[model samples]
Target: PSEYFKGMLSRVGYAIFFIPFFITYVGHGFFSPGWLLCPGFYLLFLIGLSLPTALLNKKLVGTSLVFTGLLSGVIVFYQVNKLSWLSWHKPQRQILQIIEDVGTSQTKTLQIFDCMAAEKNATSIYRVVGYSSSIQEIFWLNHKVLPEIQILPCSEAGRSVASLTPNIIKLRWSFPEFTVLTH
Candidate 1:
């Protein structure tokens, strides 16, 4: 292949490689592991389609191999950073410690409101994702399961607090902000 053709091909390859990353960022406003599914499949399809052309030209094959290596490196780097960030489950651990300190026997019911809200809002990228049972699962994993623990949304916290029994301990926690109230 001519030098000009090779240069143009390399530039096009680079552009194609970054298309998925750009799409993911635009769609989610950040890069999320979950959001990569569609883009990943699209990239795979493109690769499959390019296989015939790559096999026909030795230079194209070599260029593709280099591009694949670069792609792998970028993926590995992103995953490592994401894993490190996700490992910081400080709020979960702190909540578990508080529960342990209170002694599960003394507290009949535990209510957690605004859970992880502060963290979710503060994070610029990869916001904390959770379901209704996330707190329960976290507590269960820590082996400090409470007999009755209610994970309430911030909106329902006031109503929940009003209906709280004398035996229930209300924990209004929004990650960095934690308050324990005994009724």
Candidate 2:
């Protein structure tokens, strides 16, 4: 079990070393609720795989620390300098494209998420996708500007539900025609 623990730690030690985690979550607006669980199971799996080989040689034990340390240093370097390789230009273009695709300049009912984990957030306007139970249920929301809204069950409820932690508002799959606001 000791070797298993160390081996698992070693793999995490490497992933922690790589992955520009800060950029993906904060800058790009990415969110997955159970993301932390991925590593927990992966840790167990790594132990099962690595222990056999590590037990045969004592040197792999030392290697884990070295890999961990080396990656840590690199990650810190990128963060401190504010040097992210992601293209900021790409997202702006995408947002414009979405607007063009949605058409009619609808009054987007924007929802806010606690993306920064901060209190007292502000409202962000979004093109209304319509009131639905899920992603596919786009009916009145499609054509209407600021159409009738539905509070998703799995999401935060009530009016302030928009200010909680979600990027896209779930619309009902059965919705049909919608109104658009004139500029």
* Clash pairs (backbone) in predicted model 1: none
Every model's TM-score: 0.44, 0.27
Every model's Cα RMSD, please? 8.5, 15.5
Q: How close is candidate 1 to the true structure, as a TM-score?
A: 0.44
| 10 residues in a row with least lDDT, candidate 1 | 123-132
Give the per-residue Cα lDDT of candidate 2 at 177.
Answer: 16
Runs off by more than 4 Å, candidate 2:
26-45, 53-178
For model 1, the stretches where C-alpha displacement exceeds 4 angstroms are 1-32, 37-42, 45-50, 53-88, 115-134, 137-146, 153-166, 175-183
Tens digits of lDDT, candidate 2, 1-183: 676766666666556532564335555332232233344444434554667664736777557645654655555555433422233234334433343455444434433222211221111112122122321224224444443333332234344444442333322111111212111
**Model 1 misses residue 41 by how many Å?**
6.4
